[model samples]
Target: MSRDATSSLAAQIDARLSAPGAMDAARFASFLGGQQRLGLTHGGRALCRHLRPYLIAEHDYAAVARAAERIAAALERVARRALVDAALAEELGLSADERALAALDPGEGPFLTVGRLDMLVTEGGFSFIEYNADSPAGITDQLLIEETLMALPHLAPLRRGRGVRAPAPHRALLCALREGYAAWGGREARPTIAIVDWKTAATSAEFNVLADLFSAEGHRALILDPDELELDGGRLSAGGERIDLVYRRVITQELVGRRGLDHPLVRAYRDRAAYVANSFRTKPLNKKAAFAVLSAPEFADLFSPEQRAAIAEHIPWTRRVRSGRTSWRGRDVDLLELIGAEQESFVLKPNDDYGGKGVLLGWQTPPDAWRAAVRDAEAQRAIVQERSRARTARMPTFRDGGVAEEEVYFDLCPFVFAGRMEGAMVRLSASAVSNVSAGGGVTGLLIVDDPRLKREDNRHV
Candidate 1:
């Protein structure tokens, strides 16, 4: 699609949204009510209030999918390498216990069963900022959000004539889990699965939805906390029911923090008596420093030509926060001095964090605070990445008794299952750090099949 087509489509969408009764408060309220009844929410809060799904051109989505596949393959290779190379493992910021756990053989099956590559679709194309390889969220809810949108009477044209269709990531997730289970030597016709997470976590509702999905597919499923799991003589069970597979949602760090490295599930995993999606081996690539590893020229030889090209195109310059020298653009420089001198060009992020916690945008922070954050990141072994542009869209937002079009920051995250892109999750926010847990909103992503309808302002989505 050309830039003219994208601008025309944007105008058409804006005109449609501006039409009388198109996005009236009453209809918006009904949409919210539908979401509530369907449990499309996070921690009892409505997950999205946007009037329409984020639109992506089919061509743009294809490009993103290709880039994501290459990056995923590269990360997998690096993770496998880190298991044997102690120096690489240390560079990835793996602790002693973490290295041991990650080194444990996860039996047969890909190291990553499911992953979500968080990326920004900007005017210059998309760049992946983070790889949520361990346990990606927004799987089941993406479908539900799309269903709610499609049901809106005002969006009937969008539903029928616009060639707008939602991506089915939930189906991909199920397929990945089943394949992983079979590859792990499971023979059951319908594996008994457990979605493991703390009941107190805000994402616990999503676990219930996933369990229902498993049950509907003729598989017995249970939602279990890490504490509820028990291993008896190589058998793993939750609430006395044997589990054939564990869909681990509990972050490995939190699991280890609460139950220690010798937790029952960990023990079973080490003995190869359990099947876990995105096994402990994901720790290497899940870290923020993984981007540093991928973008740095020192590790360029580890990737193939195709992967190296993708990394150069889609990955921003990143390095682990340290006081030593590092290469930048073919030249060596003192890492700390460069960070402090060029404050506005970087972002400091915690090594392993979610929901936008402990992230300092150099352009936004005061000089003193920026220096403090730099020091803190170095001490914590965090990462500093070159700031990448996050795409913005004019979305219909609810105002006093009406709707208004407001520009908001948004990111499109592709859900990768077993190295293939199935669908994407779109998150919107007023802040630069877009996260649902940080009071941002989520919307369904629709692939626009019509060539006449495309993106706006050269942005891919």
Candidate 2:
């Protein structure tokens, strides 16, 4: 859609939200209960219960499809780079244990594992910050919410468009997951799937979604707190049930810190007693250093000519920023000078943090804060990277009995199941931190139909 059309749509959305009084907590609770009866979990299901019908009308299918294709291609490229990086890490002695861990079979053990992706999309293109490669949420959430939205009384106009509606993302996700399992082994004897994460994590609803999807697919699914895990005789168990696969949602680093190597969960994972998504091997991809690696001249032989060109085109040129004294042009320079020189164009990031935490967008922060952050970066192995302006769209949200404007950025998470890129989960946020836990909202990505695109154009004319 054109800017005007998008603006108009935003207005419509705002008007709709303001048309009704703030939904009472009781009404919200009832809506949530209704969704639970339908087996939906996560904020996704709740949001879908309220917003799906509106979205059906709000989305333009053809534009979405075009966007999806572009985003998918970019993701595939990123995946290929990750595969190459994994190989390089192995050569560098950085990922030996991870390789061993990934080699374990799902059916051979009693533990479960999960995978995640941190993604962002824009009009310029989609770029993935990292693959959660360990534990990603919202699979179940995406489905339940979509289901609820489709059932809303307000969505008839959307339902009638484009002839046939798109399939539920949850169903698609289930199919992809089962296919991933089958590709690894089979479902002849159902694998005991568990959605594993912290009990108090804000996104626990994601676990519920995954559990429901697994159950619907005929797999015995359970949601377990990572703290409750146990290991015995080379098997992993949660709440006393043998776990066959773990849809891991916990940060491995956090897990490692809390349990040490002796924790039952760690022991089972290390012992290869269960299948883990993305494996521990996905660590390298999660490192901001990995972005630097993508730009290195030494790795030129590793990428295809096309892949090399694409990487060069899409990624910001990045480098490891180090501390200490160095001589340039026979003059000694300290860390402060180096940081000051590139403050406007660079972002300083800690190697292992996410959700935009501890990130110093040099231009956005106070000069003193930037200097302190840079000093900290020097102590840790923080990286300095060129900043790319993320594209934004204007969205209308209801607030204080009136329509309000917000700037939102899009994130496309293309789930890679068993090394193949499957479908996507799109997130939009008003803040730089697009994390759902940080108050970002999820939206249905519609691939615009050709007819609709033409209609949109005609309307514009």
Candidate 3:
């Protein structure tokens, strides 16, 4: 589809969603209740229950697939090279533990398996803000919203006429785990699976959805907090049920190590007693500073031509917070000096965090506040990046029981499992910090197909 056509279709969807009696307070409340019924709650709060659906032109999804595939390839190249190429890993500024985790090798499938790249796509194209290559959230929350949207009466006509649809992210996750399990030598038709996470973590509620998905697929699924499981007598068991596959949702080694639970899982993982998808080795690539490595010219040779081009096109300028001189756009300059002089052109972020934690938007902050944020980022081992403005979508949603149409920033999260693109997690926020956990609401990712797309495809064929 042409750019104008895509824009027009998105407008039509937005208008329909905002149409009178399309979605009311009572209907929205029922949707929230449905989320609770599906276990889409984090910290006992209905996860993304208040947000409306995000529509995507199917052509845009295809473009996302092409870009995401390249990004995935680059990430895998970095993961693979970090293991054998010591010099490359050192340049990434990885901690000792991070280095080991990157080099430990999960043995099969993509090392950066089951990940998400948080990105912004506007008229020009999409550029990533951060990559959650380890333990990304919203896998089940998005699915729940999509299900509700598909069942709504107001959306019934649009769904049938426009070919509105969403892929099953949970189902893709299950398939990815089974592949990893078989690679680790699991022979059973239905392997017992455990969803591991902190007992009191906010995201624990999503575990029930995962458990149900596993069960529906003919496998035994158990939601076990890190402290509840143990490895003994040559078997890894949770609640006395033998665990054949571990879908790890917890990665904080210190917390799990304090109780000596990391020992069993790590040992079992190395000994192949059980399979752990996204095994402990994805820590380094999950860092915000990882993009710094990808964007640097020195590492260009490590990636293929296609990967390098995609990195340059879609990745913004990023560098770890430190006191030193560096090159920016081929010009040598003092890092802090450039940041201070061009404060509005940059954003600061903690290297390892989620839910928009420790993010400082330079464009939105005063000079004094921006300087203060820079000091904080330096103290916390964070990264200062070139700010990439996101395109806003008009979302017609309910606020205080009233119908309201507002321009909201949208972020597209494409999930990658075993190096393959699956369903996505799309979110909208009135603010630049478009994090679902931080009041940035989620929406059903609808692939709106049209005749123009099919015509273009036929010509290609």
| Global lDDT of each candidate | 0.84, 0.55, 0.74
What does candidate 1's lDDT look like per residue over 251-346, in tens digits? 998998888988999998888777988799998889989999999888999999999999998999999998889887677899999999989889
RMSD of 3: 3.0
Query: Residue 244 CA error for candidate 1 (Å)?
Result: 0.5
In model 2, the worst 10-residue window by lDDT is 49-58
- Per-residue lDDT of candidate 2, residues 1-461 (tens digit): 23433344435444544455534445445656766665444444443322422122223333333333333344334434554466655422334444444343334321222234554444454344554555666555445545554444333344465533443445555555555555555444678887777887766766666676688778999888887888888878876788877767777677766765466766665676765554554555566666666665665565556556556655565655675554333456564576677687668877767666667777787888887777677557777776666666654433453445566775656554444343456666766666665566665543323334344432210
Higher-ranked by TM-score: 1 or 2: 1
lDDT of 3 by residue, 1-461 (tens): 13533566666656676677777889888877887787766666665543446666666677677778788778777766766777766655566766655555456654755998898875667787778876888888656775676567655565567366677788888888888788767888889988887787777778887788789889888888777777887788877789888888886444344654346776667666778877777766777777888887877887989888889888889988788998997899999889989988898988877889878888888899888777776767788888787778766667877667778888888888888888788887889888877877777776666665653341110
lDDT, model 3: 0.74
Which ranges of candidate 3 are over 4 A from the true structure?
1-20, 49-52, 102-105, 159-162, 253-262, 376-379, 454-461
Rank ordering of all candidates by lDDT, starting from the highest: 1, 3, 2
* Deviation (Å) of 239 in candidate 1: 2.2
Going through the candidates in order, what is the number of backbone clashes in each?
0, 25, 0
